[model samples]
Target: MMRFDNIIIGMALSLILCGVTIGAERFPPPDFVETDHVIPSPTVPGPRQDIYEYIDAVVLLAALGLSSYLVLRRRSRRAIFVLMVFSLLYFGFWRKGCVCSVGAVQNIVLSIFDRDYTVPITVAVFFLLPLVFALFFGRVFCAAVCPLGAIQDLVLLRPISVPNWLESGLRLFAYVYLAAAVLFAATGSAFVICRYDPFVAFFRLSGNLNILIIGACLLVISVFIGRPYCRFICPYGVLLRQLSRLSKWRVTITPDECIQCRLCEDSCPFGAIKKPTTDWPTTEYSRSKKRLAILILLLPVLMFLCGWASSGLKTVTSRMHATVRLAERIYLEDTGKVEGTTDASLAFRATGKEQKELYADASNIRAEFKLGGWFFGGFVGLVIGLKLIAVSVWRKRTDYEAGRAGCLACGRCFQYCPKEHERLKKIKEARAKY
Candidate 1:
């Protein structure tokens, strides 16, 4: 039975790999689009909307399906490893140097400043669908779906202990980043989250020199630290964490049964699991309750400030004006009526009249900023309220003992789960003895 299970996992992985290879050969690595809005292409490339979507959809659906199957069936986790391999293959190898969610975050941030900026559907899907999944499934997308997160997770073979203070601080930082990204996205100022995405250059295999350098640094860091993006950065992960906290059900160290062998603690690479605090139960409960209260009070203020900070008039104007002007200039030069007067027209047109007034009138930078502030304030308030109510209802330790927010559902812990491992070992030993 164990052999059969392992073979099934291996075969599943092989199929996924074959699919990725075929898909990549057909489409090739995606070219990065410089702007947020769709670039007008007279000749539309194949059926795929863009490279990001083409690869992401296949990777996401496959990962989600496989992970869901493994989780639900309570099966061997070799499939999770397979998904990780495919993510790296598609993102790092096949689709090298293409814009992705990381770039999408940056594009979204850039858009805040540039009124002409509109998020690509492909970009938006990568950012949002994972969030939607997280709302119900608790960071399942981060685990199996996010190419960037999965990349780091794969590289982190060596285990290093993270200090509690550092881990706590990093988690807090993710929240801060999430707040900023949401505020910026809501205001139409930018996608700050994607701009600093370190994995982009690696995935796309090309980008700005600085961005590529950043990507290299992050790749190097992943070798030493596990999932630095999920732990410290990744605005989307931050939101997922909040959602996961309130989630009714989440991935658990033990699902149907537990032998309490403590293997999961050793196997868990990310240090996300907290050994269920059995003694001093009341104290822990009280602490969680208190913290929940403080978070509720503070989230609104933080949201308002982040929204204001990201969308303020000065910030939006300065960031967007340059991009908007560049885009406008390009549009005019492309469309302008001129016969053998390209150079003269460009030079003449670059020195424009009433550009400042025109740009200002065309952009709703100030209005967007105000709207972002209001929206974030309300959104934050709502999230906090939901969490409080959830905590109040599921006040039992068992209910709260599921998993942390943004869990990634990668089943990394399953490798360490003593119950499952013991069962597998017994089956293998029995087969050998027989």
Candidate 2:
């Protein structure tokens, strides 16, 4: 087993070097001077081959299916880890992390908002398969299939537990990120999620120096803290967390019944194992009810304030649009606030477009941002309000169970359960008798 593991590591390292060479050859920067006046293409460096795209879709389907089987039916952590390594190599190093399910979300949202945009079938498939699986089998995708998650799981050498309160607080960023990604995509402004993806740089073995540094930092943090990105930074994880709550079949720490051994108490690095609850004091319960009522009454007020405040920032948000940026740059230049012309500004001047017309277009885009900001901020406020209420409320459980929304179904706790060891022993004895 050690030899086999060494072979996999060696192969992945070799591919990393090869991917770097290929990345350098394929993604040379543009020669034109950088400027904000020109529209940026949404395209990223992905595979151009139609055959490869189809192959990727097929492989993704197979991996998700196998992951479900391994986690649910076989209940084998070794198998899951092997498959996770394969997925990291195939999707991360070889495929360069493009056309991923995480980024496919922008394509889906853009298709809904823009009439002219037609999402490719492969992209749609990549986006939906994990969601469908999460609805039925919990987060099998996050267990072993996602290249991003797999890479992080690999770097977790000395895992530490995050306080549940801190975990809940940090997860608010993912909600905000999802809202911003959707708002930007709906307005055709940007794919902010894809643009700032930290791990993609590691996968492709080359990227912006700033992004590479960020990716390295994340990996270093992951060694001590388990999957900070998945828990707090992944936008797609927000969707999966909701869906997994409604899943039909989910990961259980014990194969049979819970014996309350407490052996698996510290098994989960993500703090996903819930301890059996004790009854709360009557006074505590009464206080919680009062707090809940107050928060329920306070929810709409928070929403309104957040919405009103966010709408006021339309000017800043709208600057993400090329026309708005060009208008700002032209105004600065016209007022003698800045020096020379950029390639984009020179190109726009050659087109004989009036500055007033550009400003009008920018103004219209800001008007759109005004409404989007409302929804974005209101959604954030709603999430916060609901989170407060949930934290105040307490649920009762008699047995230690896995958190439906928080568990990655990684099978780490399986080895810690004595019941599991007993089950394996019985099976071995039965096989010997047969």
Q: Compare the candidates by TM-score and give the number of the best one.
A: 2
lDDT scores in order = 0.62, 0.91
TM-scores for every candidate against the unseen true structure: 0.64, 0.88
RMSD of each: 18.3, 14.8
Error of 1 at 36 (Å): 46
Q: Which ten residues in a row have the lowest lDDT in candidate 1?
A: 393-402
lDDT of 1 by residue, 1-434 (tens): 37898887886787686776433453444676875665476986676456646666667566666656665455556776676677667765676624454455556565565688787766676656656666666776666656777778878878676774577656656655665676666555555655667776677667778988877787787787778877777776766777878765568766547655656655555667665444446656777777777777776676566556544544344344344444455446557632344453355455674545645643555555556555654554445455444544333243212356635677767666656667778779999998
The global Cα lDDT (0 to 1) of model 2 is 0.91
Which candidate wins on lDDT? 2
Q: Return the TM-score for candidate 1, rounded to 2 decimals.
A: 0.64
Q: In candidate 2, how many Å is residue 338 off?
A: 3.4
For candidate 2, lDDT tens digit of each residue in 283-364? 7988888999999999999898888888899999998888888888888888999999878788788789999898898898
